[model samples]
Target: MKLLLTSAGVKNASIRTTLVDLLGKRIEECTALCVPTAAYAMSGGPGAAWRQISGRASTPMSDLGWKSLGVLELTALPSLDADLWVPLVQETDALLVGGGDALYLAHWMRESGLADLFPSLRDTVYLGVSGGSMAMAPQVGEEFVGWKPPAGGDAGLGVVDFAMFPHLDHPDLPENSMADAEQWAAALSVPGYALDDQTALTVVDGAVDVISEGNWRLFTP
Candidate 1:
């Protein structure tokens, strides 16, 4: 599967250009899934969150001539049926995960058995933004918002071996954000990428490439 991991939502025009260039040909053919809010939040009520996510992509996706599935429903653990969701995953040419609480999403992924299901979705192109990107990493560091870290070796889906630190250069963001990412990379003895809003890390068949309008850095532990 090809993984498109972005640090944030599509903000700059250039990044959007890169995205279009990368997927425009197949956009109209893919069944896009937007996991907007974390599953925990959805357990309460996910209507608002779903609307926010779908709305962001509706215009741009339409402009790109992409046929969005408009599947804005939440998948809870008790209600999760692989037969149901897996078909949605398999039928879709691509899956788009939106930004939110990484830990919350990770928790649900594990609970819904999606962590195991993902590897089998090898034919599906996985696109992630912010929390979405972080959810695919082996580790997401300690400062994640809204959820607690897992015990033992339960980091994330481990779809990729490296850790990801998104929103690397937001002006009002904390100074320690990047530092913590660097430190986490060192502590784990693995490679890490720090992405600005417009930057993205693309992984296909285990090959890693960077796509961005500005500079980014790679950290190896």
Candidate 2:
């Protein structure tokens, strides 16, 4: 599978170019399914959440040059079943996962059976933004998001080998600083990457590449 795990979602030219290349066509010709379920999971509601998340996703999604299929409530996918939603995913060129509650998103992706289908979609690009990126890892540090995991380690989708700590040194989210990232990395059992808004981690097949316009660091034991 082709993956573009970004901190802020196509914030730099290199990342955008990479995504367009992954599509293997002009941006205007492709269509994407924007999964805003993570954002909805953060809202802690089943009803009013959609309205809130859709509003938040508009601007960042516009930067992704394709006709969006609006929002797919991945949290609700389990009950809906693949017979209903699988076609939508199969038809779309990519999955643009918006950022929010990483753990919550990870839960639904597994439960909804989307995780099972992802690996099969080798030709489809999977673009994850912030929390979306974190959800794709085996496990991630929740300190940056001010959330506590269970007493034991919390597992993510396990789609990728490394854990990600995004928004490093972001002035607005001071908790997501380089110092905080270092602290988070120290506790990680697996390899970790600390990425700022201008950076992204791209995985095509088994190879990994870092695309950056600002700052990024890798910590490995």
Candidate 3:
């Protein structure tokens, strides 16, 4: 699978160039699907979070030159079923997944059967922001310093081998600090990546590359 996972969407020239290169075309020529399901999971039935995610995600894309952008409300999709989304997803050159509550996003991914479809969509460039990145991993734990959601079962989709903790040291986000990331990593059984706002991890054909304009670190179990 080709994945560009970021704390914040495409923050630097290096990352933007990488994306354009991966698309095999200029940003303007590519078609994309913006999924704000994660934001919905945290917004609690249509509010500020929901309103902000799409624009926040798309504004950057527009600035970068992507002309064709489609917003997808997974909950409103014919069904959460992959069969329903596969054709539409296949038509897009890439996917832009917004972030909010990781577990909430994971739950929908599973319920909609999207988690099971990821491997098949390996050819599609998947760009995940914040919670979107974390939810794709094998396991995602307390992303915030003191915020823990109810526990019952698996916490993530397990699409990727490692866990991701985003927004490390971001000024506006309280849960986002390198120290908190380390603490969260220590509690995890698997390896993890801690990324600041300007950093991202790009995975292509099993290879991982760190793309950063800010700072990031990795933790091993």
Highest-scoring model, lDDT: 2
Off by over 4 Å in 2: 43-59, 142-152
Off by over 4 Å in 3: 43-54, 57-63, 78-84, 143-151
Error of 3 at 174 (Å): 3.6
The clash count for each model shown is 0, 0, 1
Alpha-carbon lDDT of model 1: 0.65
Q: lDDT of all predictions, in order shown? A: 0.65, 0.78, 0.74
**CA deviation > 4 Å runs, candidate 1:** 12-24, 39-48, 57-65, 72-77, 149-154, 176-184
| Candidate 3 local lDDT, residue 18 | 84
lDDT of 3: 0.74
lDDT string, candidate 2, 1-221, tens digits: 79989998887778888888888987788888777777665555444235334544422543455765556777678778578889888778878887777887887787788888887897998888888899988887656343434544567878899999988898788888888888888988889999998999989987899999999999985
User: What tens digits encode model 3's per-residue C-alpha lDDT throughout 1-221?
Assistant: 58988887787888898888778788888888877777765535365244434464422432355668777666666445656667888778888887777777777776666666678886788888887788888778754322233565446877778888887887777766778888889988888999888888988887789999888999999
Q: Could you tell me which residue pairs clash in candidate 2?
A: none
Per-model TM against the reference: 0.80, 0.89, 0.87
Look at candidate 3 and give me any clashing residue pairs. Answer: 80-112
What TM-score would you give candidate 3 relative to the actual structure?
Answer: 0.87
